[model samples]
Target: MKLKQLILFCILIHIVSFTNALLRRCFQCRSRGELGSCKDPFRFNATEVEDEHGLATTPCASGWCGKVIEGGGTYSADDFDMAIQRMCVQRGPDDNEDRCAYTVYNSRKVFMCFCQGDLCNAGSSFTASKSMFVILTSLLYLYSRWNQY
Candidate 1:
């Protein structure tokens, strides 16, 4: 490839590699366990903590993890427990028209979402932070042009 093309390709590769979503085995926990009280938040597997802490949520295999917090009770009625659940999530394949239905709002006050970045679903939004991406790309462009001659 020509010098310009080669430089562009290198920059693209750098951005793509760094910006690519990270894969991770995140810590999964929830206020309501599969069983009952005495569940440990730090217990990620059977080997870690006692079963009394309920059970460790399944690890994220589809490339996402998340936390759901809902109020007004499970029924969305007044005066009830607010449920908080955190665990792995799969947004769905990109081949589909909608890569991910990140959020779904039902008639109840329930809200759900998913993320792609590693541990991004840890009670935060699904999308990865991009502020640095813009600045870095701009800088790369300037640097490449200056060194072109």
Candidate 2:
């Protein structure tokens, strides 16, 4: 009777641990940033202005051209424009010295955006590892139980 109870308890513990791990993975994947962090790159301030030459073809011209602040990563006209539309000042355009000009802001906020992107990528790998761990653990547990019987 004691052996039977012990087996049941072990099984229950394994189930609980596996379930908790799965829940964590699900929550991490659904969260905004990745791995329990904020993914937003910038706090945009919108400004309305009228273009005198009617040459405001890009949205960033009059709406919100991300405040070039210190600490933010480098910025190119293209990626900067896209980030502006997304209300995020995180993304920067590809580096090109000859054609497009780029500026690197010395701001923590800008750096944070780059850091967040890195974290997001790391989180994806972490989640994958968690999945594999769970599968292997479950298989090992089952195999052990069968061998014991």
Candidate 3:
């Protein structure tokens, strides 16, 4: 009976771990000075961004990825200032559900986009190591469960 209970507990733990692995992950980066991969015409590579830039991806509890462009020019202007930011945005229930939006904040022109995809804030894709870990852990637990039977 204890063995059966143990198996059930292991299965529950695996389910919870795997669910956490499904959280939306976004490339957490920002433009610096006049050079950065996070700027317009964003360029992203899983290894390069993680290794060369030394930036880590962030998991969003809200399941939303966001890209923010802030500048001093008008929305119609061709020239602007400041930096771009890629981050996880927590959206409230009453907030706008639109994919993109334009607004003015503190006299700065801000263009924001919210997406429901992993790594959607950047035009790139990456594999989650946590998911792989969960898979391996579950397999190990199953192996032990069977060996006892």
Query: How many steric clashes between backbone atoms does each model show?
Result: 3, 7, 0
Q: Candidate 1 local accuracy as lDDT?
A: 0.51
Candidate 3: worst 10 consecutive residues by lDDT?
Answer: 123-132
TM values, all candidates:
0.46, 0.24, 0.56
Model 3 C-alpha lDDT versus the unseen true structure:
0.67
Task: Give the alpha carbon lDDT tens digit for every residue of 1-149 in model 3.
Answer: 67866876787788767655665777788774366667767766445665647355887887777787776354634433667888887772246453677866448768878775556677543334445567668867876787787
Which has the better TM-score: candidate 1, or candidate 3? 3
Cα TM-score of candidate 3? 0.56
Local error of candidate 3 at 68, Å? 0.7
Per-residue lDDT tens digits for candidate 2, residues 1-149, read: 57866776687679767644433211111112222121234211112112222112122211112222222234643332222111222333444111222344443233211111211222233333465578668767876786687
State in Å the error of residue 22, model 2.
Answer: 15
Show model 3 residue runs off by greater than 4 Å: 1-20, 32-34, 72-80, 92-98, 105-107, 124-149
lDDT of 2 at 92: 35
lDDT of 1 by residue, 116-144 (tens): 55554443333344534674778688776
Query: Number of the top candidate by lDDT?
Result: 3
The model with the greater lDDT, 1 or 2, is 1
Residue 143 accuracy (lDDT) in model 2: 61
